[model samples]
Structures are given as structure tokens and as C-alpha cells.
Target chain A: MMKWIMGGLISVSVIVGIITGNISEVSNAAIDSGTKAAQLSLALLGTMGLWGGLMRIAEKSGLTNVISKLFRPVAKFLFKGISPDSEAFRAISMNITANLLGLGNAATPLGIDAMKKLEKADNPGETASRNMIMLAVLNTASIQILPTTVAALRLAYGSQTPLDILPAVLLTSLCSVCVGITLVFVFDKKGGRT
Target chain B: MRFSDYIIPVFIAGILIYGLIKKVDIFDEFTVGAKENLIAAFDILPALIALMTCVGMLNASGAADMLCSAVSPFLEKIGFPAECAPLAFLRPISGSGALAVYEQIISENGPDSFAGRVASVLLGASETTFYTIAVYFGAVKAKKTRHALPCSLAADLTAFILSALFVRVFFA
Candidate 1:
């Protein structure tokens, strides 16, 4: 259902673009946009590989357990129903950690993996779980610390003080996350028993 | 020296060098990935181009100027700096175009100027609405995204108001 709707929107946009004689402009934009997406994808893949490898090493070294312990409280709050020791909880924490650090490119696979784990944990006949919905919402509104991509773009384009927006970024992201989490709780209350 | 200056270039160079040294088949992988991205971009190009061209047409046709005039009284009442009106219009439609507006403000008014700082923060902190809507919905196979449209637009509005208030209080 959702898929069809999104496809329709994309189709309409493409049709409109063609009708407006914007195909040429689109072709031009495509060159830059394509290059950007490829470079970003490669970078993300590389970082995820590196992080996954390190996580394995950390597990061997006993650090994964320690990190998991550290994140237990946050996991408890964000993933309300999941047991602290659950695989889904751990993955959710790691995914959120990556997102908080503004490593969303690196966080994508972790998020998908976490969702799969959550789905597997759900009762066989149950609908989508509350934790799953909350995780999706939180991920979409993930509070960023660095805003690295935008900052990089600013620097690339010759801004003399790219990092100057750091304080503002932090403040706004904090507010956004707070508001988003609050709304999630509000929705949960209004929607019914979790 | 600020740490930001060295980090970006180093990061890019490190990626390129790593690919070359590891015999990662960087060219083949990069080109393959690039090709896939090109296809995706082309798929969405029509919408993106229409939006941008319409925006361009708006600017050329002077409708944007007139719109700005119509909104000026409300804008002034809200204490949003004059330069930001163009950006307020551009931000939701396009990322690069908004950045161009930001750049213009910074160049003309100086980077540390209140309007420039606000614009910069707004650009960094905010999401590009149409792109995000398209990408996330497309990825999730969500067709209607009934809630998503309103939710994201709300978020944008919150960011805009908060950004303006924050800048006026601190930078101004």
C-alpha cells in the first residue's frame, strides 16, 4: 500500500518534470546528484564494514558487554517493551549511538538489522510492535551532534567559519529530539495500550 | 587553527588513498555504485528539475519578489531578518538552492552577521523536505505516507521558528 503510493508520487514528479521540459535540467542535476550518491554510499559502506569489524573485536575483548551495560538505561527508555538483554535492544542502542554521532550513513544497516531482530522477537500472530514503531520514529528524528555532511559542504564551498553553527545545531537537535520523543509518548497514550 | 579545516580534506584523501592502496577495485566499485546512483537520480530527476525550474521561473517572473513583498509585513513582525525570506521559501524546495541563498547572505553581510549565522544554522539543522520525503517513503515502500507529510512539514516549521528565535536572541 505504502509502496504504491510512493511510486505514484515519483511517477507524477517524473511526468511533471517531462511535461515542464525540465528533462534537460534533470539530466544536468543527475550528473552531480549521481556522483554525490555514489561517493556517499561507498563511504557509508566502508565505515559500516570498519565498525562491524571493530564491534567483533570488541566482543572478543569483552568491551561489547561493557558498552551494552552502559547503554542499558537509554535502551530501556527508548525501547520500552524489549528486555534489557534482548538482541533487539542491543542493536537499537548501537544504532542510536551511531545516529547520535551523526553517522547515519553508517547507521542504516544497523537500523535495518535491529528491525529484523525485533520482528523476529514479536509474537507470531501479533501486529507490528510498539518498540518497532518508536524506533522508526526516533530514527527518523535522530538528534545529530556533528551535522558532518552539511559542515563539510560548508567548508568545501569556502565558508570561513563552518563550525560556527555548532552551538545552534546542538541546541536545535536537542529540542527536536525532545519534542519527537514527547510526541511519540503522547501518540502511544492516545493510540491505546502498547 | 580550527579542527574543521583539516578534517574534511583529510577524510576525503584517506578514502581515496585507502581504495588505491588496498587494491579495493576502487574504480570499478566506485563506477558501479556511481552508475546505480545515476539511475536513481535520473528516476527522480523530473520532479527535482521541475521544482527547481519552477523556482527559477518564479524568480525570473518576479512572482517570488512579489510574494516576498506580500509576506514582508508578517516577516518583519516575526523579527525574521529581511534576507531570510528568500531562504525560507527556498529551504523546503531545494537544498543546494537554499545553500546558494545562504552563501549570498554570508558574502554580502559577512559570515558572522546575525542573518548569515541564522541561515547557516538553519541549513545545517534542517532537512530538505522533498528529498527526504521522496527517499524515505520510497525506501520503506510507503505509498501514501499520510502521517509523514504532515509530520515532516511540522518539523520543518518548528525548526524554522526555533532557528529564527535562537538567532535573534543569541546572534542578533
Candidate 2:
């Protein structure tokens, strides 16, 4: 499988890195990677817990119905074969909202929930429907505004001024969103008929 | 405690408790889900290590230095700082790799230097492109993310240009 090839390549590289006088490099990489992963995990747990809880409360209070109503237009454009009132719609919106704030780690569960709902709707277990694929594409290209994890890392590293990249972050994310959405629509149309 | 302190735990507890009361098997389901994620993360470690090491080699070989040198003049002409170019190159490759470059700039030029400030901002705002693409796309098993790569790079390019412009007009 292609997965094995990719995995093999990486393993070889790490071995090569070790064989070189790059032990320190490996150690440094490990430390940095571990710290980042830990921080992200904690942040994800906290944020998802909060948001998921709020979503549950909203569901109980009938607030999700109102929120779904508000999200209908955007949902219609981004996702198809799903009604505005569907569970998938709410999950997709929540996922997008979290991603917009750059809480990607927090968005994963919502994305999974949305996909599950979509799968349930698919019923007969045909190949992934067009909407499912489009949803995946959109989620992958989800435009980020704040880049919070990056900001936190910068601060941790002792940057005197951390928020300087805001304009750049905003502009880049806008372009990505536009391009990503356009490609999804084009590809969905092409893929749908085939 | 502040409202935020109680928010997350209460939410988690409430969900699990509700699931238990409803006989939903939520605990077992969540545990299985977590286990799957752990396996997935482990599976991807090798690719992550390889990509990281290649980036490390690139840094060690001074290829990035040459690239930065080659681009500096053009960057300078555009009113962007020369030092920020290297960080831009490294940003997509490795998050810490870029940060290390940014640190060097701050140390050499002083923390409040124009280049240092810009680097700090860029560091805060950009993603480690390879890591993100690998982990996220790998999760869903979407083999052909044709649009994902170009679109994200385009975004990174936009971020680079806008950061430069903002620093030039406002900070510089």
C-alpha cells in the first residue's frame, strides 16, 4: 500500500538522521513536537468540552433550531443533500466556527459527528456521496482567522510582540477560503456526473 | 472560580452523566474512539519524522541560507525585510524550524527590530503546512486533495505579502 511506502520513507529518514551526527537534531525535534502536541491536546480537550457542552445545552433549549435557521444559507452553499434542519448541518456549522477561530483541534470531534450524521443519512452504504466529499474538502481547507495555537507557541518562545501577523493571517485565510470553495464546487460538479 | 473554569469540566461531566443515565454506552464509545485516534497518531509518526528530518537536513546544508540570499534582494525591493524570507521558507516545513530562524533574527537584530517584529508576527500566524496536511488528510483517508495544497500555499503567500505590507506601512 502507498501508506507503507510513506511510512518506510519516514522511518529511513529518521534512521539516516540518527546515523549522522544529528542525534541532537532528533532530540530537539522530539522535544518541540512533544510539547506542541501536549499543549494542543490540552487546549482541544478544554475547548471541545466547552463547545460540545454548549451545543448540548443549546439542543435542549431549542437554540440549535434558531442557529440552524441562521446557518441555512451558508449551509446550502457549502453542503448538499442535507436539509438546513439536519444534525449534519449543525455539526458542519460548529466545525466551521471553531476552525474560523483556529481551534482546529477542537473542530475534529464536530467534524466526525457531522460525517457520522451524513453517513447515517446515506442509508444504503453507497460510495461516499458528493456532499460527504465536499464536506471533507471544505473542512480540510477551513479558513483560519486567529491562528491561536501559533500565537501561543510564539508567546511561549518569548516573542516580545506576537500578534503582528494579523493582517497577513487574515488576507491569506480569505484567499484560501475562496479558492477552496471554488475548487470544491467545480470538482463536485465534475465528480458528480461521472 | 471564574465562569470559564467551571465551563469545560461541567460540560464533559454533564455529557457523560447524561449518557450513563440514558444507558447510552457513551463511555465505552468514547474510549474506543480515543483508542483509534492514538493508533492513527502512532501510525503517522514515521512520516512526520521523515519530513521533519528532511527539513532539518535542508537547514543544516545551508540550502535555506542560499535560498534566502537569492530572494533577499527581491524581497527588499518589495519593501519586505530580508530576514523574514528564510522564516517564510521554513514555516511550511516545520513550525519549530521557523521559530528557530525567528529567534536568530531577534537575537541578532534585537527584539524590537523591524525584522524581529515581523518575524514574530509571521510565526504566530502561519501553519506548519506539511504537518497539518499530513495529519488532517491522513485522518480521513482522502487520497487526492488536489485543491488543498495549492490553496493553502496561496494562502501562505498572501499572508507573507500582507504581513510585509502591514509592517512597512504601520510599523516601519
Which predicted model would earn the best TM-score?
1
Can you give the TM-score per candidate against the true fold? Answer: 0.60, 0.55
> Clashes in each model (backbone N, CA, C under 3 Å)?
6, 0
Interface RMSD, per-candidate values to 1 decimal: 8.9, 8.4
**What TM value does chain A in model 1 reach?**
0.65
Q: Which tens-of-lDDT digit does each residue in A1-194 have in candidate 1?
A: 33453354345435555766665554554344434443333333433343333333333344434555677787787676678778888788877766654544446667777767776675423344555655565665536656654554455445677776777766765665566566656666776745
Model 1: runs farther than 4 Å from truth?
A1-71, A122-129, A156-158, B1-58, B82-111, B128-153
At residue A25, candidate 1 shows an lDDT of 53
Report lDDT (Cα) of residue A50, candidate 1. 39
Task: Give the Cα error of residue B49 in candidate 1, in Å.
Answer: 8.0
Candidate 1 local Cα displacement, residue B33, angstroms: 14
Report, in order, each candidate's fnat: 0.08, 0.09
Q: lDDT values of the candidates?
A: 0.56, 0.56
- Residue pairs clashing, model 2: none
Candidate 2 lDDT (Cα, 0 to 1): 0.56
Candidate 1, residue B61: the lDDT equals 39
